[model samples]
Target chain A: MLDYSALRTVAAVIQTGSFEKAAGLLNVTPSAVSQRVKLIEERLGIVLIVRGSPCTATETGEWLCRHLENVGMLEEELLKQLPTLAAPDEARQRVTLHIATNADSLATWFLTAVANFTKQSHHLVNVAIDDEDHTAEWLQRGRVLAAVTSLEKPIQGCRHLSLGALRYRATASPDFMARHFPDGVTADALVSAPSLLFNQKDRLQARWIRQIIGRELAGPVHWLPSTQSFVDASLAGMGWGMNPELLVGEHLKAGRLVELRTQTPLDIPLYWQMNRLAADRLADLTREVVQTARLLLRHEGR
Target chain B: MLDYSALRTVAAVIQTGSFEKAAGLLNVTPSAVSQRVKLIEERLGIVLIVRGSPCTATETGEWLCRHLENVGMLEEELLKQLPTLAAPDEARQRVTLHIATNADSLATWFLTAVANFTKQSHHLVNVAIDDEDHTAEWLQRGRVLAAVTSLEKPIQGCRHLSLGALRYRATASPDFMARHFPDGVTADALVSAPSLLFNQKDRLQARWIRQIIGRELAGPVHWLPSTQSFVDASLAGMGWGMNPELLVGEHLKAGRLVELRTQTPLDIPLYWQMNRLAADRLADLTREVVQTARLLLRHEGR
Candidate 1:
């Protein structure tokens, strides 16, 4: 077994990026964290870390620390379900949920889903917005109880439920589309046409083109990177690209932009992937999401 | 940010079904884990857990504890990489790398890969064996820094490199194959033939049949969950199913087991996916695995 106290102190130090900051988070003097690491190293007979201005874990030390952390997470999750097993005075009162999500979901219906459950759920959520492709990884790590993912398969011991499809329209301001795709908008024309993307990792545009042309997506595509800018770039007619229907519904209705591909608009089926342990919470959240999807996106033909 | 310390303690209590056991693992008085959880609940303004003989986290509480675990894992991994950032003492040595791998890799080249990284890598490896499909989920929860996964794309902030193919051949004792596959079996005959699998999660038999016959695999397949048992069952003629080439090499050479297909094996391309962060120890370990693959399994073809 590894020395978890030493490990925890070391973790706090890394999180704060300095002994001083770690001390603040831990509510201990910086000297205490320092002394603990020293004693741990001496006892273990090995160097567990490398201290720079920002600090890092040595391979062996990091491996142990990572294991310790996993154990901690598993234990914590188990505790939530079995809190009443502890002594009366020791019974837990509040629960915290950590989730890795995307900015769109975080900013949009995700919070509403939480609100739907909050009346009966006395829990706080720590939402970290990352890419959808990687959100499911958090579930595998035992970090979050649930996640909104593009993946169809569930992680081990977890279950997956389809929420609804997110419809995307390839729209551009009429003037901008005319400026860039002036050659009567052939597939080839749009292939190299300047388009916007959420980030370097975003491949929505290429994916849209592939569906239409029946080939791999390979071409010159511009990256807008940020959600706001992606929408801005499309509205500005800098390029033609897909935009989430919810985000640009009004614009499309007002004719600010023209839908490029009427035949094929990108509609990704979204799924709610979660650990199977918390059956009630998962079911509630799933219901809330499905209900929201039905209310908000039913007309989009999912 | 939640009180991870409290969550860890509470989780331990539940796993061990006793605060005493949890305390022993936590290196604290059972009272400490007990008190910490009480305080955590008070601070959170919610009833997070229910205490009893075997503790259980409430739906709300489990949610939070899971998040705490995730952050704890990432934090632990980071600290291990940069331990000196906390103490900077010359005493700490030996970097650790925790990896969750499959049984075959652990019993075979995984250790060989470990042996290859001698210089600058005094590693403490925590090897976990599970199905390939589920390994990346472990990586996502911040449980391990790297993993051998079936995923083509990398996890968040991680890079994925192909490790070539893992070819599995359906083999059986020559006597067994001769008796079972009389008249040299056709694809359709496989539906009724008994087969072997690594575990309940093992789907190689179904996958292989699907690949060859373009249909679902449904038959009287025997379930030998352990790596050793799976091999033994096939050798004993209990069934014919997919087994790794390395384990079956000698038998194939000795004509003890007959290959089931003309294009007789299923090839699953393996990938070495790791966090993008540079660690001398991890780099050295990766180098060793790559070298071993080149020598042992590279020529099998992807």
Candidate 2:
């Protein structure tokens, strides 16, 4: 069995990007930190860290880090089940749980779920902001324990929980619509109008165009990568864009943004993809996420 | 010669992530957009775009986009040389230039350079914010035409120019330092104290620990990903951190932040890396970036 304390030291080093920082985190001497790492390396017969300006884990080191993180979560679950086993003076360990999520969900309803979880548990949340289409990459790389993704299929060694659908509306400032498409959103008018994009990877605009206009779209495109900035740009009449209903609902209702008429709103289904660990904390987190998502998002079947 | 118009159509589609959007951009019907794409595919006898929710360019498509962008730059240069060749009714096309840069640079002195360039040239600047260590990935993927990186070595098909050094100081709020280390920074005190980090990838804290304490550091770490937030967290007494001289210079002088005495400040050398394109616009941009960097950053080899 691996030494949990040594594994923790190794993880701290990688996370903090230095032996000294890891030593400081573990409340151990620099020599102690070094000794622990050396002991592990000697046992494994392989180099673990590539020391430089900031230290990075080798391939084997990455695997070890992942294992340590998983084991830490399991240990926390064990502590919850058998409170008698916990030493009186031993403080409850705060497991660092890394999660990958999209900007829209983060901006809209995800934070509430996170806030609820943190209030109930002693855990550090490390969130990696990414597009829903791409969050799986973090899980695949073992960079995150869980992710909010658009993909329904589970990654190997992971399970999927369907959250719900996030509805989006193609919207623009009233002044923008008047200036760009004075008559109506026809083929010719669209050619001259500028549109807002979240990023190059964002397909919502294109998908919406196909669904609404039933044609290829052409226009000047402004790429605003940040969610808040994208919304602000849309409000400032930079261009029309697809805005999540939760984010822009108030703006749409208050006449700050005008929704372009379409046959149906674009609904993107989101899923919680997590490692298949039977940890209570993970289960509790999943429950909170599902409950919060259901309260905020449209039912998937609908 | 390849049809430049069709090539532009293809690029717009890829950028906008939809055929309909590309058609809208080209001021053509959806069928026209489809025909242009089909024509290009037939001419090349290879697929260019992989149709999906958001269309992505195939290997051939990426090459074509690069060619078209280069050709567009050359055309602009030609127009500049021979004003008589310019059509009276044809508006000047705004070239899009993608640049990858570190977050610190983007948050500090880079925007001034961009603003200056935009004032003089009709070009749309797309800035991709990444760590200095990782900016080359964007260049390798052809996602960016230029990059601001710390790597001294040039990537294949690219050239590198030394920008300057960005000095960093180990600092914390006065209250934080007193609370954490009542006495001077000893190894035992440092281990128990909390530190603020920019992100998991950030190594400035670790580097500072090694330089200042000459040993491994141990501490509770708070990861704040945003540059502004990282500074705010430090100011809020969350933890000590390595603050950029440019960003925290005023704070240090104003007594808001106390500098931890070390042997010397950490100086990180930066470089401007770009494709070896002979476009005048590219030349102009490089000149502006180099000039601006020299003004803000410490001149290297001085």
Measured by lDDT, the strongest candidate is: 2
Model 2's i-RMS, to one decimal, reads 4.6
Specify the highest-TM-score model's number: 2
Error of 1 at A85 (Å): 8.4
Model 2 regions more than 4 Å off: A1-6, A26-52, A58-60, A82-93, A136-143, A152-162, A173-175, A235-237, A245-265, A298-302, B1-68, B83-94, B101-122, B132-198, B203-302
Question: Candidate 1 on B102-177: residue-level lDDT in tens?
Answer: 6565444555665344323434344555678778877887667788887788788787777876778878777666
Please report the candidate that would top DockQ against the real structure: 2
Candidate 2 Cα deviation (angstroms), residue B95: 3.0
Per-model interface RMSD values are 28.7, 4.6
Query: Roughly what TM-score does model 1 have, to 2 decimal places?
Result: 0.43
Instruction: Give residue B230's lDDT in candidate 1 (0 to 100).
Output: 49
Off-target runs (Cα >4 Å) in candidate 1 are: A1-4, A38-96, A114-130, A141-145, A277-294, A297-302, B1-302
